[model samples]
Target: MGNRGGILPAVGALALLAACSAPAPAPVAQTTTPASASAKPPTTGPSSDAPALGPGPGSQPPTTPQPPPPNSPAEVTSACPFLGVTESSATMGVVLDAYAVEEAKTTQQDATTYHCTYASRTGGRQLLDLFVTVVPGTGQIPSLVTAWTKDCKGPAKPIGGVAGTTRTCSLDGADSGDVMVLVVKKSHGQTRLAELYVRPFTDEVYAKLAQLLTDRL
Candidate 1:
């Protein structure tokens, strides 16, 4: 009985030692969850590359203005002042595109004047002045011619036109008839006096305009 009891204790001790000597199971690995695919991102401000909303507040509209129809009579008359005297009554050859017209009162007789400022498409600009005044007959003409002739280098001579006969005096330093001081008198069948002055560099147009004034007196 003692030997058996000793054997039993030895077996129990061996079992306890075996259980302690066994390796501990690895610690359970922790599982991690990834982010969701459908999640929304936070908003900051407007993007740098966003398209513009619309035109600026002070911008002009993007449209072109339509011009008047061709062969308008009013256009001919509008260009008549700067036109040569011969061309004053001309219907054709009037280039409305070359000019812009403005009207105002002149210093002489509160007269109505047409200032035709021409800007050439080819390149330069020139100003032509046409002044209109009234009188009882041709009596106001002699003094007018005298006034224009004072500064003229050329003799004042008869300038006949559709209106009537007057005179022109060349300015003291003018070149080959390019510019002259010209005057004319005429009644378009009435007693109103139409007198005009030419400064310099426009004689052909002046004579043309003068000759077309009246059919009668």
Candidate 2:
């Protein structure tokens, strides 16, 4: 009976050890939320409904619009200022009454010019063109004289007792019949150019007319 009792205790101890060593039911196979589902989604770019930005304070201001320039070389009244019809008729020995004038302005150079034309009253046989140019600065008169007398082939003959430098030239051509050009420069940088077309070109008459015009200038 003692040996059976010992055998029963040993069987009970084996059952207790087996129960302790069993693999703890495999931890129940846990289910949890994924990391991607738990975290916030990443942004793509700026929102389409956002407000637009304007120019900044440090940026340059808009430029102001400029005004346009005036029309150049426009015609004006046809009255002669320095010379008149009576004086031109007496000088050229013809009857002159008709007169016409045109004006031109150079804003860049700050200069103004007036072109006066005188014709005979009888048959328009005799004609004279006088151009008066005024520039504000000095050294501008020579260029005007050069431009006016560029077509004349005669040598420049200086005259005496004039306000400024005076020169006369007679052009040489059948098309340019009896053409005499006279250029006079005044003290205040003003220039007067005269182109005469008469039947007979007389130096004495041209000198007298030049004197009268320069005296008036």
Candidate 3:
């Protein structure tokens, strides 16, 4: 009976040891509530468990820039004043059809006539050299010619009558045979061909200019 009693206790000890040695079941995940369980869905970007941020002052949308329009005449005019035609009205007794860019003073040593000219709109040709000066003390036309001739060569042959109590002479060695210098005293002002030189020289152009000075100036 003693042996049997000992065997029974040993069996009980083995079963307890087996129960302790068995692999522990995986621990179940707890169903407890997390601190962020009742939190709202993110309205902005994701972040750590920080508090929801309120909108800051004046968070308006960004503005987009617009491009300027092409083919604006006002912009072009503002940029290039010379690109447009500059015309003289018929009222300015002495009028030019084109813009007259002021030239540097001629190299002539003794010059009294204040000279300016408008280039032709037609062919980029020089239309006329407009001269203005005080009426001479002497009634001599040659003196005025002498004053005009200081810059230019002396003169060709003196030609009589094309217009207005005036005598003309071609500047000697002038490249253009169409070149001539006339001296005239008109009603409004003294309109003279101080020097009229044209390319592809011809006497016809010269004659035409002489007549124009007569009819117009």
Q: What is the TM-score (0 to 1) of candidate 3?
A: 0.36
Residue 148, candidate 1: C-alpha displacement in angstroms: 3.5
Winning candidate number (TM-score): 2
lDDT of 2 at 7: 8
Candidate 2 steric clashes: 0
Give the count of colliding residue pairs in each prediction: 8, 0, 1
- Model 1 per-residue lDDT tens digits across residues 1-217: 0000110011111000000111112222222322111211111111113232222353333222222232222211122333342233242234322332222222122111222222222322222223232222334444444543343466765654423555555433444322332333434421222233333334455555444332211
Measured with C-alpha atoms, the lDDT of residue 213 in candidate 1 is 32
Model 2 clash pairs?
none
| Model 1 TM-score (2 dp) | 0.40
lDDT of 1 at 94: 42
What is the per-residue lDDT of model 2 for residues 1-217, given as tens digits with 9 covering 90 to 100?
Answer: 0000110011110000000111111111112422111111111111113222222244223221121122112322221455565666687676544443322211112333334433323323335544444433344455544544444456655544444556665444342433443544443443333333233346666666666655544
Error of 3 at 123 (Å): 11
The digit string of per-residue lDDT tens for model 3 on 1-217 reads 0000110011111000000111112222322332111121111111123232222243222221121232222211111111111212222233434443332222111112223333343333333333322231234344444433332344544444464544344333445322343434433332222233222234444554444444333
In terms of lDDT, the best-performing candidate is 2
lDDT (Cα, 0-100) at 147 in candidate 1: 42
